[model samples]
Target: MQTEHDSTYISFSREEWASLHPSSQINLTQSEINHIQGLIGNLTNEEISKIYLPLIEYLSINMEAAKFSHHVKNQFLKKATKNPPFIIGIAGSVAVGKSTTSRILQSLLLDLPARPKVDLITTDGFLFSNNVLKAKGLSERKGFPESYNIRALIDFLSAVKSGEPCVQAPVYSHLYYDIVPGQYHQVCQPDIVIIEGINVLQTPKQVGSSIPSRVVSDFFDISIYVDADESHILKWYVERFKLLKKTAFTKPESYFKRFAELSDVEAEGVATDIWNRINKVNLEENILPTKYRADLIIEKSSNHQVDNIRVRKN
Candidate 1:
């Protein structure tokens, strides 16, 4: 019930957000939901029905409006303006469910009546390689703004926005914690492209040049910021770290293999250290500052449930 009239977005509690689309059907099965959710757990089919179904409906309406806008522009130009892909940027801190949200949205959008071609691209793939980072002495700041090849990421987005038939993006492997050599993700004529990352909503740093500045988010038709209290994010990061230690970190070739044998207490300490030293710093310096830039801000509870929704008034 609390809100600011001057704020760009009007806030709504989770219950109110769900009530906005009471007729939204849960087309996704439990198995499907399971596959879409990332490391953070505690998701149920009912939660998906209440939270994401309404979100999908809201996005569908927006997408249709975007198409109509393109149509009108093309009409005024007296020429066919090729329909470019509708790009949605999802940004948040580590373990904040950006991947899960992107994957679920991709699935739901594809099932729409038009059956739009939805492509999900994570900005992790755009990170500089470990070798490159090492060469630049930036290994410790891997997820920081300067650690990414922002130019290349912007170029890839520009290509997609230009309605290019096919574009390739570099691939980064979480297992090795580095970019895979000679590997690229091919995005071919997608009707919608979801760009998920910690820094997708970030603005370009001033380079003190006369060159026109362009941010990665300039291409987005809609942008979402997954938000949660810093305490919740820290807890989620620690929990996911423990889960990975039991799972992926145990693999011999995993970059984090050394932590695999850590005792629960030791693992928790490492997780906390990582959060305080790197993730939290990055969140405060780069990620959270961009929350207001999003068209939608989805606030999550400590249990990984959507607690509320805020939509930009304009």
Candidate 2:
């Protein structure tokens, strides 16, 4: 069967990818692994040692290469400041484990001998406020690229790339399903940063007419796409919805609190409809189209575990 791809990438089975530069040191503890695992995730330390640890080892090499290039540029320009932090971008479909993979990488990178400080930010915070979306009649398209304040997101990255001291990113709440009012994640200078979102790799032309001079991926030193069959993602999304219906949706303040009392079949049906209508459409037209743009792609199996990996040959 054909896999996700083009001639630009070389695919590797999970075993081959794990063996590329195997590391014996499992930097993350079991507790940390548990915390890194998302609602629908079953991440284990073995996977860390087998998959992510080696992945970061590859990243570290790239990071060093970037710094060397920066150093040479600085010398020619006669300046002394070190290069800006290495920025990594992660993208994938909803419920495809992008967030969990990002967190795990952040932990592993920090625990490296350099122990460089790392910050993670998600693009959810850049989403147009619920009020704004409703006003613009985009209430049904929350996760679509048009729903985001792409300029604001680009501005945040511009500041980071410029090595700004303290840049504040708007905070987003999943429970409330909106940007938090007057709240922000203050990002200080760090050795590395990871930006996570479903649409990070999307191009402006695909997004709409409001194209920035530079797209989000321009600032990324590395980009990753978490890949899985849409069928698997549909199952995962509905399962997560049902799980949340019993948990987060139960809270009175949850934006989806109305779903809290849904019966099993009712909850599944609602979630399925949402996927068919909104998320799947976004994934097809926007998210999946950008998959090949990633420097690395982690393909997952039906069980949501990494089954293969593809790295850009260039």
Candidate 3:
């Protein structure tokens, strides 16, 4: 890793980063890899070895340090060392592949020597339901920070960090395009939790000094931001929309069923417009501003391959 421009980050090229992988061989089976790879994501064994192995090595080291600190703290207080999850927050723009990255991390992290339990959750579930958004007139800004139930998200994180058992997180469905009422994913106190969302890195503003609450990112031991050129992200988003139009949107129960009737040309036009009006604005106004706050930044090429990595200097 090399420092440039007196920046807060130490940047590493793909090959340079790969050379730092842990000594022990770590193999991910083809089926496991296939399961982590998403429809819009590209990951091969080579990329894992090159881009992710070194990362896994780094995270393992940090996990060990966290355990040591916990042991030390508990010992000082004459208490047993209880498991406190090492929370990881992953932030990125829509279609920037954050979900795929989080899934890969969760899968690999679980296989470490301890065979720890790992849980993955997305901030999408924290988003307000369509009914709520429409009621608040934030329907056009669905992904914007204002559209989310920030208090609930932070409360859930607080519970997890405090080692609360069977903590439930709201469930969201892309088919319904909203949070499913009364459905939740129970998070049993795991060794690690990976929370992925565009809002993860954002530091919520404390308006008017109401009893200061712990921000969501504060609960994270490590934070990552997936980044790609806006043009590339725009293209990927449109392509994903087109694919969804043919598949998901065709389902009778889908909230976007109307989109299934559109011609290819019309679908692309609508997708591009949505990208410009909603996603582009959100990326520029909120998401991009928080990139520097992440502990690590994963830079992707136009082809969606991780090309460079930036780790914030200690």
Candidate 4:
């Protein structure tokens, strides 16, 4: 039988845990299980099993903990108050597999019997329109925090926290490199809402002596940071860029369509230049600085496997 680790004390090594379960037993149907198996080639069965099962268990436990805390607080106040929906923030450097992690977590959380209604939202949708960026002469700094409409993001979160029946968020297109007009994703009241982004844990910019009203982290019941060495991430970013150039960039409507026409040598150089100029700079200035704010950190090995998980003590 699986047992819950004590909240105040938890210790386990990857090797010891792997020895108990050499392979992951996927609970999904054959077809779905096959698809996942295809995605993570050669990963130990144990690693795959632990990926979702333990994750779902951990999240469920945390949600319950949040509820108990709220109950105690309400009792102390001698008044009734609605417990806000649990919000999770996921942050990582560019090309550090954050998107993949988010998708996996969403799937795991949704599969949980107790928390089947889980929603996943990405900060990409909150990014300012391309025209707006051009007008402000900030097109090159596209992924920076300033390029996003902070007020809109805050309002969306506020609505989610208030238990709104339906909230619409914009959808962004990677091929077009812009927000698709009139294409909004509607999120209903979910048991959990996962907000994944490169800078989700960043502190809110202060206006005056008064401490900044509320940083995005204020809304998060839990936060996770996917971490890896800078050099490894840079290499992954460049490789992913090359893959995109062959795939999405070939589309006529893609902003980077011209990249598809470049020779192999030229493409590598272009990918490197973009990594060094834009993505790397954003990683250094905006993303890396927020690492300490995460409640949990998943450090990736060179092979892109999660080798260590560091959880902040309460």
Candidate 5:
């Protein structure tokens, strides 16, 4: 039986979901188990189980629906036909846990009974290099839509949808805070492609218009936006910054190595300042505006649990 999370939609909670399939268990690989254990400090196993299991189930169902839809569309074209890959776009604000969500979904979706080959591609790879952004005088607008190679991203997606044998996408290195030249991820024909980013659903800027036009979302078969209050997201960002400073920033090659020596107070202040100056402004001016366009919205509370979900009606 389906349970309504709200008046308009029906979905199961983690506990309820667990009860439904007594014989089935979520089998995690050793590395995946370790990853979940690490997150145990901030999230409970039950929470992860409940939030993600259902999400994976939903994605599997949707992926099949997408495949069927593609097949039906192709039936009309006869022998000249090829179905495009189903593209799922995920968007959210910084520190809203969208990255974790994307990764989890990618793993879970691959484990489905359909056993569809899945590929995870992040839009971060499409971001212009620091030098390019600096030359264009847009370095400070790092996560802004204009900071990416929109056409290149679109071309990559188009190739993937067309079932190209091999497609290469540039890689972005968070440690170095730059695009690593000559390093790319090759994606073969995948049943589904998950594209995650800060502004995946945004409309591209028109060629000559003052505002940016939309590029990628136009190709998505389904889209999700991770949502939370601005204040809550800000706090999460600050906490994550502190955590990363204590860990990743200590690496000599890290772009934020200088942050490792900061006092807690100084680090908090710096994180707050960056949030205010860059992330917050970009969320307001670009990201949030596209929320309504999402097929589904996952709303999280300050504690990072998804308390509610909004699914658009057919």
Candidate 6:
């Protein structure tokens, strides 16, 4: 890792970080890790035992402390203590493995002693529908901050933190590239909630006096940001796009179906264009700026392995 500590974070090499803990108490198998892998990256069971297992243990420690704080506050108020879901926000640039990290955390969290009911939600579900974006002239900016229903997202998270029994989040479809109308993913009272997205750490653009100034991260008990060089992420994005052409894009109803027939050279050109035009802009302007706000940052190597970890000290 680059020379340590020019910032609020304390950085450690993967081995150093792993050595901080004697061993991972969690028993996740290789096949289980494969099942949670995302489109662009692969993770082995060893990586999990060394990196994520320690992180999971850290989160569980925080969860217990939060529960205790809640109990203390309730006692001060002479009210009954209620354990709310511990919310974690996972933010990173597209194709940098945030989805895989979220899924892995959700899986590990389930085995915690609390046997927490963990629910993973992607902020893609909060994006404005393509029709709405088109009407607002933000079709090309779909992944940008303005393309999300910020108010609705905040309200949903607020309700969840308030211990609401059930809440519905809009469903988004990658194949259709739009929100699935009238479809909602119901989240019951989970013990833990992981909200994953490129912009989960972002502050909403100020609209008017009617909206609160709080950001989505305000509801998080802890947050993680997956980190990698921009060059590496761009390459991953292109690679994923190429893979999608052979997979999802081959479906007749896939919005990216046209890409399925493109030659390898043609597909590379298109992926490069899309990255340069859209995803790169979003990453540079929105996503990267929020990385420092995360409580823990996991830096990935070119091979998509967790190479370093930085935990914020202050």
Give candidate 2 misplaced runs (Cα > 4 Å).
Answer: 1-4, 25-30, 206-211
Report the C-alpha lDDT of model 5 over 87-127, residue by residue, as the tens digit. Answer: 88999998887777777777777777778788889899999
What is the TM-score of candidate 3? 0.94
Q: What is the Cα-based lDDT of residue 27 in candidate 5?
A: 53
Over 4 Å off in model 3, which ranges?
1-6, 22-32, 206-212
Per-prediction TM-score: 0.96, 0.95, 0.94, 0.86, 0.88, 0.95
Residue 313 in model 2: lDDT: 89
lDDT of each: 0.89, 0.91, 0.88, 0.78, 0.81, 0.89
lDDT of 3 at 154: 92
For model 2, how does the per-residue alpha-carbon lDDT over 1-314 read when each residue is reduced to its tens digit? 55546677888898898888665556556677778986787787678878887898889999999999999998998999768989999999999999999988988888889889999999999999999999999999999988999889999998988889999999999999999999999998888999999999988564455545689999999999999999999999998999999999999999999999999999999999999999999999999999999999999988878988889988
Q: Who is ahead in lDDT, 1 or 4?
A: 1
**Which of 5 and 6 is ahead in lDDT?**
6
Error of 2 at 252 (Å): 1.1
Residue pairs clashing, model 3: none
Worst lDDT window (10 residues) for model 5? 36-45
Candidate 4 deviant stretches above 4 angstroms: 1-13, 16-24, 27-45, 73-83, 206-212
TM-score: the better of candidates 3 and 5: 3
Question: Deviation in angstroms for 170 in model 2?
Answer: 0.3
The TM-score of candidate 4 is 0.86
User: Model 2 clash tally?
Assistant: 0
Q: Supply candidate 4's per-residue lDDT for 223.
A: 90
